[model samples]
Target: MSALILVVDDEPDVAELFRQQFRKELRASRFDMEFAQSAPEALERVGAAEAARLILILSDVNMPGMSGIELLPRARKARPDVPVIMITAYRDSETRPKAIEAGAAGLFTKPIDFPELRGEIGRRLDAATGPQ
Candidate 1:
């Protein structure tokens, strides 16, 4: 069975972009991706039984109701074993520190480097599952 990755972003287009970028992996069944357009939806998904397959979370920092940084600690509380990586278009001085302090596993700036992100995901999944 493939591991699950949850992606949370306010923008509607972000989901399509992730699907396109991770198309090969998705086709190969290396992992499955799920999208949550808001932090509340993400939290629901995280707390659900479906989260049993969850290994990672990719969340945008600037959502309307709850920013990714704000969601970080709550998500961790819900599923401490899963790692959360924050993504932001802003990437200001305060963002990084706030994310880290809130328990983010990593942070990525927007117009994300997909290859690097993929590598990081691979590493985390590898570490989680151990040797194939």
Candidate 2:
């Protein structure tokens, strides 16, 4: 079975970019992509999809309500086994330390390197669900 990956970002366009970047794998059902526009929405999706095997969560740091840093602990409470990686344009000393403290699996600065992102996702997915 393919791994489900929820991407939490306020930007609506990011979902499209992810879909485009992983189009081949998506079409082949190697990975399933889900999107959430806010931290609340991400939590809701995560809660609702309890039966689904989610391998990773890619979250944006900045948002109108409940930034990724704020949401990390809550997310971990909900899905402790799943890795939550922060993806944001802001990469400063302040936010980095906060994210690390909040237990982010990794922090990725935008514009992200799609190849590296894909590789990490693939590895995580494999680790979570075994070979596709």
Best by TM-score: 1
- Give one digit per residue, the lDDT tens place, for model 1 in 36-86: 999999999898836558999999999998888889999999999999999
TM-score of each: 0.95, 0.95
User: Residues 3-68, candidate 2, lDDT per residue (tens digit)?
Assistant: 899999999999999999999989999989999999999999988875557879999999988989
Q: For model 2, give the 10-residue run with minimal summed lDDT.
A: 46-55
Best by lDDT: 1
- Candidate 2 wrong stretches, greater than 4 Å: none
- State each model's CA lDDT, in order: 0.91, 0.89
